[model samples]
Every structure is written in C-alpha cells, then in structure tokens.
Target: MPKLKVIAFDGTEFDLEAESGSTVMENAIKNAVPGIEAECGGACACATCHVYVDPAWSEKVGQPDVMEEDMLDFAYETKPNSRLSCQIKMSDELDGLIVRVPEQQA
Candidate 1:
C-alpha cells in the first residue's frame, strides 16, 4: 500500500494507506478525511473532490485530462496545481503523495 498524505483546510494532516490502483478520492473517503467531498464518486463528472497537489509532488502527479480540467472550473479557488482527486490513481511511485483539500467544494 502507498502512503498518502492529505492536508485539510485547517492544517490537519491525515496519513492514509492506499491500495495501488485506487484513486485518491477513494482512499480519502475510506479514511474519512474531511474536505474531500467526492460527490460524484470518482466518476470524473464532479469537482467536489478537488485538491491541490503539493508542489513537491506536482510533477509526479501530472496534469488532469481535458474532462477533469473542464470539471475543475466548478471547484472553489482553482489554482495552477488544482486537480480532481478522482483523476489521480495511486501507484508505488506515489507512496508519499501529498495533497491539500480546498476550504469548500463547489
């Protein structure tokens, strides 16, 4: 399992164990990490699972696809690192991936 670090809006951090093939949003929901709403369940149709990839892990996480980018427009406070968690799959290389949840969902 890869270790995923999720930082909440209030600065709280959750260290979660995630299965390699699962999406970030799925692990977040499983661990009850607050701030990742995941309203569309990893379908890539909603922006509720919006998060900011930490600068250190940005390149490793890569950019979201066109559909995800289009959905991110509905997220709150979109930034250069903004991404839909559903679009990010966990892998061994992402063992220490870190992401920050937005203050609120769209």
Candidate 2:
C-alpha cells in the first residue's frame, strides 16, 4: 500500500494508507478525511474532488485527462497544479503525495 499525506488549505492533514490501484479520492473518502467531497463518486462529472498537488509532488503525480481538465473549471480555485482527486491513482512512488483542497466546492 502507498501512503498519502493529503492536506487542506486550512491546514487539515490526513495520513492514510492506500492501494496502488485506488484513486486518491477513494482513500480519502474511506478514511472520512475532510475536504474531498468526491460528489461524483469518482466520476469525471463533478469537480468536488478538486485538489492542488503540492509542487514538490506534482511531477510524481502527472497530469489529468481531458474529462478531468474540463471538470476542474467548476472548482473554486483552479490552478496550474489543480486536479480531480478521483483521477489520481495511488502508487508506491506517491507514498507521500500532498494534495490541498480548496475552500469551496460546487
């Protein structure tokens, strides 16, 4: 399993375990971590799972797909590093992945 260190703009932090195949949103949701709504349930339709990958960890996470890119427009604070958590797969290389949730969703 990989470890994810998901954070929020308000300083909330979640250090949870995740399988290599699951999405970041899935692990966060399962752990009841605040800030990741995943309202679309891992689908690309909603931007509730919007997150900003820490710049230090950005290159390791890679980029989002077209669908995710489109959905991100609905996010509160879309940035160059913004991504839908549902689109990010957990991996050993992402053992310490840091994601920042925005202040609002919807």
Candidate 3:
C-alpha cells in the first residue's frame, strides 16, 4: 500500500495507507480528512473534494481530466496546482504524496 499524507492549511493532517486502485478522495473520505467533502461520492460532479497538490508532486500526479478540470473551476481557491482529489488514483509512485486542504475546507 502507498502512504498518503493530506495536510490542511490550519495544520491538520491525516496520513493513511492507501492501495493503488483507490482514489485519493476515497482515502481522504474514509479517513475523515476534513477538506474533502466528496458530496458527489467520487462522481466528478461536486468540486467540494478540491485539493491543492504540493508543487513538488504536481508532475507526478498530473492534471485533472476534462470533467474534473471543469469542476475545479468552482473550487474555493483555484491554482495551477489545484486538483479534484477524486481524479487522483493512488499508486506506488505516488506514495508519500502530500496535498493541502484549503483554509475554507479546513
């Protein structure tokens, strides 16, 4: 399993062991990470699962798909590094990934 580290702007953080097939959002929701509401339950509808990937991990995770990209536009704080967590599938390569929840999401 890969390790995931999700941090919030307020200094709250959750680390969980994740499997390759699970989505980042799933891990967060399962662990009760505050920022990811996942209101749409992994569907690419709600932008409530918005997250900001650390710039260092940006290239490793890549960009959100068209649907996710569109949803991200509605997120609280838009940025080049912003991504909908539902779109990020965990993998060995992404172990130790660090994403930050926005202040609002915190």
Candidate 4:
C-alpha cells in the first residue's frame, strides 16, 4: 500500500496507508480526514474533494483530465497545483503522496 498524507484546512494532518489503485479522496474519506467532502464520491463530477498536491509532488501527480478540469472550475481558490483528489489514484510511484484539503468545497 502507498502512504498518504492529508493536511486539513486548519493544518491537521492524517498519515494513512493507501491501498494501491484507491484514490487520494477515498483514503481521505475512509480515514475521516476533514475538509474532503467528496460529495459525488469519485465520479469526477464534482469539486468537493479538491486538494492541493504538495508542490514537490505536483509533477508526479500530473494534471487533471478534461472532465476533472471542468469540475475544478467550481472549486474555491484553485492554484496550479490544485486537483480533484478523487481523480488521483494511488500507486508505488505515489507511495508518499501528500495533499492538503481546502477550507471549503464547491
């Protein structure tokens, strides 16, 4: 399993063990990490699971797809590193993935 680190809006941190193939949003929701509403589950249809990929891991995490990009338009305070957590699947390459949940969901 890959390791996941989720930081909440108030700076609380959740260190989790993420199963391979599971999404960052899934891990956050499963672990009850606040700030990741994931209202539409992992369908890529909503921006409620918005997170900021740590800058050091941004390139590895990659950019969102067209559908996700479209939904992200509804997220609050998006940045170059902003991503819909539900779209980020875990893998060996993402063993130490780190993400920060937003203060508010879309």
Candidate number with greatest lDDT: 4
Stretches of model 3 off by over 4 angstroms after superposition: none
lDDT of candidates 1 onward, in order: 0.93, 0.87, 0.87, 0.94
lDDT of 2 by residue, 1-106 (tens): 8889888768888888899999999988998877788887997899988888999988889888788888988888789999999999998899988888888876
* Residue range 1-106, candidate 4, lDDT tens digits: 8899999999999999999999999999999998889899889988999999999999999999899999999999999999999999999999998999888889
Name the weakest run of 10 consecutive residues (lDDT summed) in model 1: 33-42
Residue pairs in candidate 3 whose N, alpha carbon or C atoms collide under 3 angstroms: none
Count clashing pairs, candidate 3: 0
Tens digit of lDDT per residue, candidate 3, span 36-76?
Answer: 88888988888888888999999999987888888887888
Report the lDDT tens digits of candidate 1 across residue range 1-106.
9999999999999999999999999999998889888888889988999999999999999988899999998998999999999899999999999999999998
Q: Once model 3 is optimally superposed onto the true structure by TM-score, how far is the C-alpha of residue 70 displaced, in angstroms?
A: 0.8
Ranking by lDDT: 4, 1, 3, 2
User: lDDT at 105 for candidate 3?
Assistant: 41
Off by over 4 Å in 4: none
